[model samples]
Target chain A: MRYLLIYDITHDGTRSKVADVCLDYGLNRIQYSAFLGELSPAHQRELLLKVHQRLGKHGANIQLFPLDEKAWVGRKSIEREERQNNE
Target chain B: MRYLLIYDITHDGTRSKVADVCLDYGLNRIQYSAFLGELSPAHQRELLLKVHQRLGKHGANIQLFPLDEKAWVGRKSIEREERQNNE
Candidate 1:
């Protein structure tokens, strides 16, 4: 299933680490702190655990929203130009 | 229908304006540039049109994703603390 992942971490290092985890799971970064892509249910749980462990005791917010294929395609995005820096 | 609204605008003024539209529609801001809430399909289209108009020729990106109630509840979030500044 496809999932939309959103996170806000105060620390830069931890933020990038979470981004790395998202990339490792084959998710595409849609924004500086957001990712969207397909992942198995098991992998989704694993990713959540990884982020939870990294965020333990630290003040950060991470949310995972699973979307079915139809719902994923139903998303609407408008862009005039691509961001030069994907990071 | 629950919708996730995400946007990235180069100009701070435009970004805030887009956020205002979200709030005007009774959507809850979930991050610096994201909002989540329930809306009727007609209102959803209205919100999209508003965002699109506000974003015209400004090189901004806005995305809207509709989620069913089950999918909305299926989301998981972790936060150590609430942000002092809602804006």
Candidate 2:
């Protein structure tokens, strides 16, 4: 299965740690605060737990969404390669 | 079908306008720069065009993803309700 994880963390430290956790789970950072990649159902649940633990008592918002192939393949994006920080 | 629209626009004006467009299209602002809601495939295409027009070569990154019922229903979220702005 595939998952799309997006987050908004006010604390810089917490945000960085969260991003690291996502990478450890093999998720790619698709946007400044968004990650997308493949994961087994079990891994997905485990990842959420880890994220929840890190987000403890922090000001943040995170959402993890499961995306099937049909939905993933149908995604549309517009980006500017020249932008230094696309975020 | 359900769509997840997320973007990173540096230009405050452009970002604000884009948010307005999403609201006009009957989308809910799920996060600071992310919107989600139901829309027909045709409407999805049109929405993208409108967002593109608003970008107007600005340094922005936008992605629109189609998510079916299973995926949408499987979404997991963790938020701090007290946060002034859950961006």
Candidate 3:
């Protein structure tokens, strides 16, 4: 199944760590704090647990939205040129 | 259909304007730079146009993803406490 993961963490270190965890799970970084990709149900739960542990009362917000085939197909987007720094 | 919209805008004024546009389209603010809600296909197109116009070579990045029923139903999330300032 496909999934969209996004987060908000003010602390640079914690944010980077969470991002690394997402990458370790093979998720593609779509934005600085957003990721999208495939994962099995078990892996999804595992990822959630891993992310929860990473958060560790850091007062961050992370959401993982599972996308079925239909959702993946129905997705739409509008993107413009972004500065290299922001990208 | 459900949709997820996220953006990164450097200019404070531009960012606020873009955020207003998203809210006008009935998307609820999920994160500082993310919004989620239902939108018809036509409205989605209209929103893209409006947002595209708002960006207007400002070098901002905005993406709107339409979610199908299955995707919306299968979504997963992990949110920890957020600071009042960030909220």
- Against the reference, the lDDT scores of all candidates come to 0.82, 0.87, 0.81
Best-fitting candidate, measured by lDDT?
Answer: 2
Tens-place lDDT per residue, model 3, B1-87, is: 789998877778778888998899999999888999988889989888888787755677677777777667777776667546554
**Candidate 2 deviant stretches above 4 angstroms:** A82-87, B82-87
What lDDT tens digits, residue by residue, belong to model 2 across residues A1-87? Answer: 889999888888889999999999999998888999999988988898998888766778899999988888899998974334454
What TM-scores do the predictions have? 0.87, 0.89, 0.87
Best first by DockQ, ranked: 2, 3, 1
Give each prediction's DockQ, rounded to 2 decimals: 0.47, 0.55, 0.53
lDDT per residue as tens, model 1, B5-66: 88778777778878999999999998877899998989998988898777645678777888
Q: Determine which window of 10 residues in candidate 3 chain B has minimal summed lDDT.
A: B78-87
Worst 10 residues of 2 chain A by lDDT: A78-87
- Model 3, position A35, has a per-residue lDDT of 90
Model 3's lDDT to the true fold? 0.81
Minimum summed lDDT over a 10-residue window in model 1 chain B is located at B78-87
- In model 3, which regions exceed 4 Å deviation? A82-87, B82-87
